[model samples]
Target: MIRGVRGAITVENNIEAEILSATESLFKEMIKANKIKAVDVASVFLSVTDDINAAFPAKVIRMQEDWTYVPVMCMKEIAVPQALEKCIRIMMHWNTELRQDEIQHTYLEKAIQLRPDLTKQ
Candidate 1:
């Protein structure tokens, strides 16, 4: 079966370094919480709020040796009114036996408010 794991994080600023750092932290936490292997990831879709344009979160993740072979894409989040600012989000298409309900979703920093229901699961 294929499952999708989601994750999001907030960056304090729109700086490139901040975006990259927050993305790395968010990805690390998501991986740790779900116990997922890089080899199992089919592809990753990353998006950032309109306010964030200093860097592409997916590019930062692709720097990992294991991720070089993984397909990744970065896009701009729809600019909805009252949407979270400086937030980066990721959805990983994983080839795994885990059921959809068993997949762990992660939300870190201020982004936790985005999906409180999934944070603890």
Candidate 2:
């Protein structure tokens, strides 16, 4: 079976450092919550709001030696009126037996408001 863990975070600004830091932090937490090793990851898709163009989110993941071989892609999120800004979102596919509802989805910083239902805990 395959499962996916979703995560998103808002960066403090559009600078490369801030984007990389926030994205890396979100990836770490999502990976931890899913209890998945790099080898278990099939692929990762990351997208950021139009407001963010400072860096490639996948580049930050590749910086980790363990993820050197993991397949990753980064793209710009769809621009919608009043859409979340400085938001980086990732959906990681993992080969696991966990059911859909069993997986954990994480939203950090202002992105948390994007999924208020999940933040209840």
Candidate 3:
């Protein structure tokens, strides 16, 4: 079966180092929470708010030792009115046996407000 693990984090600034660091942290947390393996990841899609243009989140994944072959894409999030800012969101498509409800999603920093229901208090 295939599953989608979602995660998001807010960057402190629109700088390359901050973006990459935040993305790496979010990706690590998501994979750790769900016990995901690099081989099982089909693809990853990252979306960042318009204010974030300093770097591409996919670069973080590509830098991982075992994630070289894993496909990754990055795009700009829709400019929704009143939406979150300086946010980086990721959707990882994984091949796993776990049921949809059993998958763990990660939300960190100010991005936690985006999905209060999924995030632990």
Q: Which candidate model has the greater TM-score, 2 or 3?
A: 3
- After superposition on all CA atoms, how large is the RMSD of candidate 1? 1.2
Where in model 2 is the C-alpha error above 4 Å? none
Error of 1 at 33 (Å): 1.2
| Model 3 segments more than 4 A misplaced | none
For model 1, name the residue pairs that clash: none
* lDDT (Cα, tens digit) per residue for candidate 3, span 35-85: 889999999999999999999889999999899999999998999999999
Q: Which one is best on lDDT?
A: 3
**For residue 29, what is the lDDT in candidate 1?**
85
On TM-score, the candidate that comes out on top is 3
For every model shown, the clashing-pair count is 0, 0, 0
Question: Residue 55 of candidate 1: its Cα lDDT?
Answer: 83
Judge candidate 2 at residue 56 and give its lDDT: 92
User: Per-candidate RMSD vs. true structure?
Assistant: 1.2, 1.1, 0.7
Local accuracy by lDDT, each model: 0.90, 0.89, 0.94
TM-score of 3: 0.98
